[model samples]
Each structure stands twice: as C-alpha cells, then as structure tokens.
Target: MQVMDPLTSPKIGGNHLFCYALLFILIASHVSLSASARELKVEPKGSVKDLVQSSKATKIKRTVNGLLEVVLVDAKGLKDTERFSGGMDPYVMIKYKTQERNSPVAKGAGSKPVWNKRFSFRVQYPDYAGGNGYKLILKLMDKDSFTADDFIGETVIYVEDLLVLGAEKGKYQMLPTKYRVVGSNKKYNGEIRVGLSFTPIR
Candidate 1:
C-alpha cells in the first residue's frame, strides 16, 4: 500500500526552487560587475638633495660611507599635510646588485640606519658581493605611524665595477647623485608630493 502526501510535497518543492533561483541571480550579478570598477591612483612627489661622503675612499675599498637628504612636499606644492605624521624617520639600504637592471629582490645583506628628516641620512656600504655595479636604494617613512600612514621615497646608486670592491688603496671618490620624491599608501586614499633624491654612486 502506498500513501502520498499532497499538500506538503508541493510547498517543499516550491521553496527549494525559490531558494535556488535567488542564489543563481546573486552569483550571476557578482560575476558581471566584478571587473567594472576604476582603480585608485596614488602619487608621491619630492626631490633628493645630494650625496656627501665623510672622507674620500682609496682604491678597492671594503667600506664606503656617505650622507643623503630629501625635501618633503605635497600635492599642492610644498603644502604640509597630516600624512607625514609630523616628521620623517629616514632609512637607507645598500644592496649588492648583479646588473644595472636588477631590482630590490636581487639585493642581499642590507643595512638600514636610523632615520632623520633633516633631509639627511647616513649610509654605509658593504665591501663584498657576488657581482659588479652595486645598487643603493634609499627609503623614508614616518617615525611614529610607520605601520599606519606615512611616506616613502627611494633612489638608486650605481657603483662602477666589481674591481673597485677592494679599492681601499687609492683615491676613493664618490660622485654626486639625486632622487625625485614620490608617495604611496595601501590603507588610505590620497595623493602625495615631495622632493625626491635618486643618487646612484657610480
């Protein structure tokens, strides 16, 4: 003997169908509009002052030292913003680069000195690497809001040859260099400007 429930069967079937239809429409709309929005634009503006060496090095030197500075600015041209978090704590990194076209990922065993926004930071270069033409990348961020909001600037310094790695016995001359200011933010939406310094020691 078979018993059929007429009322409950139709109601349950209708509910399931309604739920499935609603889910399908939502998913379809999400797929269509996912790629139709405009991306944000962030720009940094600044300038790098100059590179100054403590005492000139001799030929084939193992260590080199110098000073770097950058003038901070804003989008409105020299207008100070709350973005700087009051002052900048600067940092400098010297990377042993393989070629002139290599990037930060190709760098190794770097040094970051304490930052000072007087547009001046002290930098130190290592003596050994596996290749010629080492690159110097300089960066700056907020001393207080380093993890929150701040500014960052970078410039490259190129050394001549790997042979100069040990040029400690001759006149160690450092050339002049400069960088242009630029800015970026991953959490907020805005534009930035500052004088950037990009001086590569070649």
Candidate 2:
C-alpha cells in the first residue's frame, strides 16, 4: 500500500477553486430559475360564446296552477351599429322574473331583424308578477366579438293590457301592435312588432 503526502497531493489551487465556485453559482442560479418558473401560472379569459351559453343555462322554476302563456311572434325595425365584417347580427333576450329565453341570431339582418321565435313563460295567477302591472321587457341586442352583446333598443308591453286587449277583441291575437323601442336619452330608435296570446292553463 502506498500513502500520498497530505500537503503536496493535488492541492486545490486558486484557479480550480474559482472554477468550482463558478460551477456552484451556475447550478444554484439554474435551480432558482426553474423553481420560479414552476410557480408562475397564466389564466385564460372567457369568450363571448361562453357567456351566451351560460346565459341560456339560467332558467325559471315554473309553477303549475293557473299558468299564463306569452307568445313571441316576431320583431321588426331594430337599428344596430354594424360591428361584424359583413353586417350586424342581432338576437332577442326575453326575460320575465326568473324565466328567460333567447331567440336565434338574426344573421345579417342589420336594422330589420325578424325572429318569429316563440317562448312560453309559466306564471301562477294571483301570485303572478305579470298581473301586477309588470311589463314584458324585450332587449334587442347586437352580438359582438370579444365583449357582451350590445343593446340596440328596447320595448315593454304592459301585461295588464295584454290580457285585457285580448278579452276586448274576443280572441287571443292582439293585432300587429307596434311597441316603440326607446333608446338612450329617451329617443325612439325603432319599433318592435310583437303579439300576445294569453292562455289560462287549468
């Protein structure tokens, strides 16, 4: 067995020590950078389509006894600012209390949008909100790209007038009644054409 001298055997010179220190620093820096990278996260923003789908999910819990049926015939004379490439796309959001329904997109309809879409909202008489002078609010909106839908105009029909007008005519069809769509600064933007047929369910 041969033994080497402690003092003369491969002494760590200043150059080797400096190289070791540099290697240690490099390794530590790489580890630190890796840890920092692992902690970072990026969240994504929700799209407009997502919002539309979510809105569809929120529905009303209908009551059984003495329900009222409101029919949505069609809409006309809606003026919307052009947003999309070709033309404006519009849709209707029909809301009453906890009940809500969305009309199909009026593709390339521009100002004159017609959705002959029908939606039924159930309400118990006496306990019903429509009988209490609450009007049916229709918000004509333009669907945009990144943001929420833009409001084109709005029209509200008195619920009391709906049933009474039908009783007076002796039929459900309340004629082609034109509700003036009011806009910003109380200006008349356009008229929305809608019909009401009240059916009292047993």
Whole-model Cα lDDT per candidate?
Answer: 0.36, 0.64
- Superposed Cα deviation of residue 153, candidate 1 (Å): 1.3
TM-score of each: 0.29, 0.57
Alpha carbon deviation, residue 86, candidate 1 (Å): 3.9
How many angstroms is residue 135 displaced in model 2 relative to the true structure, after the best TM-score fit? 1.3
lDDT of 2 by residue, 19-55 (tens): 7779989999999999999999976775534433443
Q: Stretches of candidate 2 above 4 Å error?
A: 1-67, 83-86, 128-132, 164-171
Give stretches of model 1 more than 4 Å off: 1-81, 84-133, 145-149, 161-169, 182-202
Q: Per-residue lDDT for 47 in model 1?
A: 19
User: Best candidate per TM-score, number?
Assistant: 2
